[model samples]
Target chain A: MTAETAVPPTAAYAADAVLTEVVGLLVEVVGDEILIATEIDRDSSFNEDLAVESIEFVALAEKLEARYGARVDFMAFLSEMEMDEILTMTVGTLVDYIAAQPAGEPGGEV
Target chain B: MADVQANGLRFHVQHLRGGRASTDRPTVVLLHGLVLDNLSSLYYTLAPPIARAGFDVLLYDQRGHGMSDGAPTGYDVDTAVDDLAAVLKACGVTGPVHLLGNSYGGLIALHAAYLHPESVASLILVEGQCLDPAHSGLRPAAGGYPGGWVEDVANTLNLIAIGLECNPLGGDLGSRGARKAARMRAGADTLLNQTTLIEDISTVRLLTPGELAQVKCPTLALYGGASDLVDSGPMLAGQLPDCTLEIFPGAAHALLRDAPKELLASVLRWLETHSPAAPQFTGSAGGYRLPASGGEGAP
Candidate 1:
């Protein structure tokens, strides 16, 4: 596990900062296999680029929830789209979602 | 993602807290089938809907399958029951739980309930294999239980072993399929056949009529209408007093893969009726709410 996997989300939100943390979590999920840390950029797609399997994606979702708590309503975020959309989502897309959220509204009621 | 140490082995456990996590709701524990299968089967299918219906869901890769540690021995029903007990305790689940087992997992669930009735609140067996001579026609004419499903299971194991040895290495499957199939085959070739999994399971004791009667928890048993295992469903239903048997029309043994929507519909209804804890529904604030019976979240 990387240091980012253990760090709690900060009160502040920056797109780049969220990207860095997301990439780190991806690294932890990908482990030493196929995941090339340097290749994961904002446009990197989970399926096309990382080839993340279903179970691995589930693990990534769990890791994201554990690190960010209620701030990231990962399931709710994916609920609006189809599985294909979720699989094709880019790292930048997730960063934007995280950056767009209000600071203290971690309940994610919206 | 949880790594629980139970039965002297490290198990990959996935516990999904529902909307009512803080409430004293009954947890639903799912058990997957033997080799080449894992918690992913249930995780992708029934778990989310059940969670949405307001119950915490717990799924784990059984020992030697998926991410769980593999042992060479202890594949018998007794060991499986002991493992379930230990895993529940390790996961801090002390209250009575509803067990949903698929394939061989159903056998383990029935045995576990019989052995430790206090731990299990109810059972949902899907295409459960009845290995005893009394259930199937494979028993010896001399009035002794012999080889039956064990041989079939062994055949499947051998096929998996061959697939493991030849297919992936020989470049037959797709890149991702090859990787996952290779991993599954590794366990099949190593622990599944090389160990005593077949012998232990073949000789494992089946529940007698009296013992089945003692497991009085509300039970739901499903089987495919056209499946060869259809007879086992009624046999099990006759044994358990409070059991409800539902056979899906024109479905086969691979009911999970086939007719998932219908299966989920039946499961949701069964849970709503039998779950000891009532569902705690919180308004989704205009979000999606699953109909009392349907397969909206299926993939």
Candidate 2:
């Protein structure tokens, strides 16, 4: 799960870059075995497509915190969503959230 | 993905940092229930708002549950208490902290406070089954189960074990392309079928009234109004010296899942009134920090 591009931490990441990072984190979470059967993409639904269980989602949140730092606020993003919205959320939803963050800021609201 | 070596086994743990970097409030540790339950239950529910309300939160999968290493033995309440102490030690949590437990986890929390009173600041028990039916009047006639809480839970697990053995839902779900569900089912199958979980649960020594009276920490016990374990709520409130009880109307045993908003409201209010530190709520401004390198995050 190596970063394909070394974008400056101060610059806002492109949507594609966030997607790649998210997919890499997913690989770390659900395992690379998932990649052998299905191609992860922006449209991949966490529940139906990837079968991301609640515990695995927590793992993904931890990874996102490690990679993108506190500006990502994955738990805050989740706190605003209803149960159904969370279950039906897609990879693009998270990627877009990450991409929208003000790059390299000390702190920001989700 | 944090794993802590505690009680001679690897346990999955998640720590959510609060709003302030430094505060006098105690860190909140949440414990999930038995089979089919994990840290995620509280992780998605009470954990976030509690963190947002300026208290560092800790959630962990108990032994033989979730991503933690399983064992064929040691499922009794005392062992679970030891595991909690060991997990706290492994995580470097030395100060007295709050313990919130749901269902079986509630039983563990009660025992922990009773045994290690100095280490626990407070307790929150949600549908905790700590009293024996014979003594607490939680017989089969009241809860519609075969026996007391322990016996009823053991019977339910035995039924699930038999069903899993006969049908093997994990393999079936995997064949049907549901990998996550299959994995969860398989983990449950291993714990129920292969381990001494049922036997250990059946032999659990329910807390006596005298012991409950000895747990002097401030306690909040929440239960669903319609849950089978609702009876324990009043009993806990009556026994524990500093206990407050709340029963959500029309909710069942799964209070966290069924009434998360209400649960969050109660929990936030409880922490606010009881927390020693000044309340600081940054809302979305709250963010959790990953443990520093070579800290609890290390495998």
Candidate 3:
């Protein structure tokens, strides 16, 4: 399969710093199988273009929640999107959502 | 049943063979949930009925369960499935076998199917959760019938309580099955957790799309709407492919005992829906014998 071409980042969301860190977590949770380059961005669909599954997203949510002192509601993600949608979700979307949430002690909830 | 002497393993298995066994009907192997009244609980409740439906049913206890010898290596998911594999091999019970796992047994079956998809025909999960060591109902990770004898008993009780709450067969949340489950909880037996199983979750994610796609076989996820094992069973159903989900309106985790007639009907219906041919095995002196050598491919 050809690498999913990354949607260009047009330097629009300068405040989305948390996404850089979230991409690191994604790399760790997802490993480097589908990723071709480290120049990550929000337009990546974690499952679709990238091949991640719903379970790993739970791990990603837990990892982000812990690393950032935020409680990402992983269950909500389970209901809202398929793995394909997640595979291509933009980094801006992820960081914006995390920043919107209240921070807490980082950890997994079961 | 013919037996194969596995290297380093003391147990030898017997494969009950024949064209007489060749009813062309598929077999559903029964794995015990917990708190064994021995393998009889599985065989008596599940095996014959499944056979009557023209599906073959294999029932056995885990190490330390029923007549099976216990090992210091003892109860966990891998060993349980290994024992099952050894049993299937010894009996030449090859080809696709439907696995019906109750409680922890169901979890082991999941591991088995995941690791050795070739051996698994399909899965019939009766309240089995995709457990992570971090998430079973127990409060302590190191519990069950271990450490001192007291912890072991407590662990067993704790283990039963988890299955009771999550089992699809358990009857009305407050019914006799619940009472029996509560009583089982108070008595406790074995404490098998899934730390190793948890470590293996990453492997599950490693399942290639090809493997997942190959799993186009029928899957039935059953839950007695009365049980509390999970807040939701349909949610799990949605995650699986080619799955048929059902809620036994009044049944619970102990469906066989809680609602025997209903359980029988539902099981037979599911078996019929899944099985391609009539389940016929010539009655033998030892048990149901085969009509032919159990084949090496899908039924």
Candidate 4:
């Protein structure tokens, strides 16, 4: 899902580019009015801090799959997290989770 | 704060003593979703019927949650649990009480009950599953993620946004009748911005079967048929030592709003069966067999 960026990404994003991308996606869906950072911190919560609407969150997630060439298990993520808990994630965290996954196919049964 | 103490912190609180049972008998303490204040979550729908039900009910914000006071440190399960315990105590509730937990609240219910089994009589877990280390449903790639890291991040964010909007999120605060609406939004933003909480939450996905074996109480595990939220419930039911599971066909994770009537009735029946002393309700139990959307399953 890599696209040619007008400007090359520096090592700065390398730390948690995925997280930045997610924050970027959130910016698009909720608009600039909603202030959201890339790396979710311990204190962040959706209802209390992000003001993200559930419907909007769901739509954005579906759209995310199209860019990455994968189908993420939407429900799986939902069942486990709270809005605040969601804010603390980092791009590095996802990279680690995906990097270790078995090759071939996406959205495993579990 | 309203001087309500749960665990150890003081919280803003409200009470509707054993209100109307939308589903019927037995007092249920309606828990709010993640980061939402008591007024934001309950003022919209739950409080009315619960008051009329004649069963005792209590609603309060958690520390660092909603109007509840935020500690200098941050939010965590242990703090939330303490707040819950304190609130129950303030309400003068000592014996076992029915639980109506939603989203993260569901996690708290299970944890609190396990920690203090004598406090929780039965559980009405709505779209929430246990987080047992052994049964953790989603296997963290041992050491990695499944696909493009950037894409995964975007997907997670987008999905989260959609789920939130569909929920009972109140409207803009600009309107006079909707001042609280603004507070609700502000609260949401606070909830979403916590990066640490997200990382911490990721660590909990599935509950081990052994942990489920410990929940011996009669539980009515409710899930939305249309929602992926069931991923958590499957393992939760499988692990729970005693559980009566039912899927509200067609509804999403926010069944309370998506199919309020159906869910309300089903919950009542579940209580009646589990506890014979359950009270009578204005709504009928059979009305919830199908979806409120009127088709195959639950709305």
Top lDDT prediction, candidate number: 2
Go through the candidates in order and give each one's DockQ. Answer: 0.15, 0.43, 0.01, 0.01
**Interface RMSD in angstroms for candidate 1:** 3.4
Candidate with more favorable, higher lDDT: 3 or 4: 4
lDDT (C-alpha) at residue B210 in model 4: 60
lDDT of 2 by residue, B1-299 (tens): 39999989999999888866325677899999999999988888888878888888989999998778999998998999999989888988777788999999999999999988877888999899777757754343444444678888888999999988887754445431466667777888899999999999999998788888899999999999889878767766888999999999999999987888898899888888776654445556674443322123111
lDDT of 1 at B299: 7
Q: Count the backbone clashes (under 3 Å) in each candidate.
A: 0, 0, 53, 103
Model 3, span A13-42: residue lDDT tens:
323656667877888876764356335666
Candidate No. with top DockQ: 2
What C-alpha lDDT, on a 0 to 100 scale, does residue B246 get in candidate 1?
Answer: 96
Worst-scoring 10-residue span by lDDT in model 2 chain A: A4-13
lDDT of 3 by residue, B1-299 (tens): 31234323544221111234435655577777654434444544555546545555665555544334444443555666777787766555676788877766666676677667766767877766543223223222343212322233345555554675465254453433354444333333232232222223223222233343445556666777776544335544544567677677777767656665666576678777765554445566555644433455322
Ranking by DockQ: 2, 1, 4, 3
**Candidate 1: segments with Cα more than 4 A from true spot:** A1-20, A36-51, A76-110, B131-147, B162-168, B172-177, B277-299
* Model 3 reproduced share of reference interface contacts: 0.00
What is the lDDT for B194 in model 4? 38
Candidate RMSDs in order: 9.2, 7.2, 25.0, 21.0
In order of lDDT, best first, we have 2, 1, 4, 3
Model 4 stretches astray by more than 4 angstroms? A1-110, B1-3, B19-26, B36-39, B72-74, B131-185, B192-196, B204-206, B276-299
